[model samples]
Target: MKNFAYTRAGSLSAAAEAASAEGADIIAGGTTMVDLMKIGVRNPDALVDISGLSELEGHEIGADRIRLGALARMSTVADDPDVIAAFPALSESLWKAASPQLRNAATLGGNILQRTRCPYFRDTAYSQCNKRNPGSGCAALDGGETTLHAIFGGSEACVAMYPGDLAATLVAFDATVATRGPGGTRTIPFAELHVLPGDTPEIETVLEPGEIVTAIELPVVPAMRASHYLKARDRESYAFAAASAAVGLEMDGDTVRDVRIGLGGVAAVPWRATAAEDSLRGSPLTEATAREAGRIAFADAQPLEGSAYKIALGADVVAGALLQAKSRMGGE
Candidate 1:
């Protein structure tokens, strides 16, 4: 890793100011940023540490929504009784991520902002990763290992997946992100936080330079209490998902009254499977109907050779998650 000057910001405004400078990057938990720096994917000249900013600490569960402070530790949120009861999918996503040690140290904002685990992008030896170097071309597309590449939201230039668990649940529940920057504070739809890998693959998120995510707001609804997150991975723990689904279902006497589906490990972003939700909104909640909805979710998938299986796997994940959500409707 390149040597960099570090400054612990006293306040959110200070952190934003320091991060706005050229060649500067924000560090909170340092879980993801430090890893990228060591791999030469990130080489900032200055590090603005926001871990001490008090404004970004703690969480509040209110009647209307749950406000999760950006600096809230993953373990802390995962263990919150209110979160586990009302937003079980969020809690499950956090607990299922990384390991116990990482959950103790990693913050919610850093988790959402974490970079992709694409091998081509991480190894600088391969000079064809567009996400690492714009216009360099994507090695993953040119006969490279594409088992973890995206099936949706991939342009010809890039096909890397987002690779996060919590964001999938957040997107399914219509969460919003709050940010403070040099231009002041603003709220953004959680789904809009990560941008598609269009022609410019290096630019990942819509967050501006020096903008610090302050909090994540999730609306409380009846369906969210019955939500579930199912992650299919190479291993049981401390592994990135191969395919996952975050689903929330509101049933009306075995019929779907409302449903929300978010797909992970299969897209460039935490994909909201609106088509799948629409397909099952009024249908009976059954294995056949759920499976059909899952198929509809992946109907427009554009998968590479090694990633074609993700289309089927992701679909099954969605179906399973929906059934699991349905089972939890009133039993929780």
Candidate 2:
């Protein structure tokens, strides 16, 4: 809603150069950025419209990885034959996000970079939100039931979950994010993109001020076809998840070979379940094993006062997702 200067970038350097000024922000689809600005949470003196840079578009599925240009549209990736056949979890995750209209305009990079939807984080109507204004104190504690708050990797200062549907799937797939910045281009594991709100909840990602997202890369996942992403939200449409899981499995007959699990809605980040995957690897794909894997995923979860239900819900989400993924694998 605030008046601001806007300019398009010709290339990656141009984008970074345009965004180098203090209080400057990049606009891809302008979905989350514009929303944050409307709430007065973001006040960019200049808006670098990177949407015009065709250099940051398209994807290439190579022998070992899929290179995703930062500007590749969500709808385009969701419908790609290779992504559909191989990275079913990635494709399903995108299609299951926002509305079709939103997906049409939303880029893969933008989807992963979307901000948390915590009431305290997004509501400018509220006077105190540590995320919007650090050290202001979180009102969700005494004000209302914060059932949607994070359960993992939260400090006493903040408990807002990192909210994005596609991001969870990307982390599970071991995706890497490429960025071009003031220093030079750098690659970071997608799982390392988000930083916990230890003291500063205002800063979400590790990208430098002048760093522009270039691409996201996913290494080959042979078990990707035997994958699934499921969300238990308030409704079947136009909603964020309440509890969700992204799962992929490789098997030798009924014996699990490799398993990857990632959870959303319960963590400050898209939480990769190393314990659950370890429990399932080299084990028989039975209901009991699946249940154990799910439970192990939440063994270290620390829930808030009013949101203990997430531990059980998160476990069930992982279990259900594993079962569904195995069923699909059986069919294959």
Question: lDDT per model, in order?
Answer: 0.91, 0.86
lDDT (tens digit, per residue) of candidate 2 on 1-332: 77889888878897898798897989999878888898887888899989988978998888788899999998898889988888788888888888998989988888888888888777787767888888888877656558888889887778888878888798888999999998899999989999998888778889988898889998896778799998888889879888789999989877888888988888888789998999998889888888898899999988877778888888888999999999887632
Report lDDT (Cα) of residue 202, candidate 2.
77
* Residue 120 lDDT in candidate 1: 94
Best by TM-score: 1
Candidate 1 ranges beyond 4 A from true positions: 330-332
Q: What 10-residue stretch in candidate 2 is worst by lDDT?
A: 137-146
Best by lDDT: 1
Off by over 4 Å in 2: none
lDDT by residue (1-332, candidate 1, tens digit) is 87899999998888999999999999999999989998899999999999988879999989998999999999999999988998789899999998999999999999998989999999999999899898999999888999999999999999999999999999999999999999999999999999999998888899999999999998888788888999999999999999998898888886788899988888898899999999998879888998999899999999999999998898899989988888887522
- lDDT score for candidate 1 against the true structure: 0.91
Shift of residue 150 alpha carbon in model 1, Å: 0.3
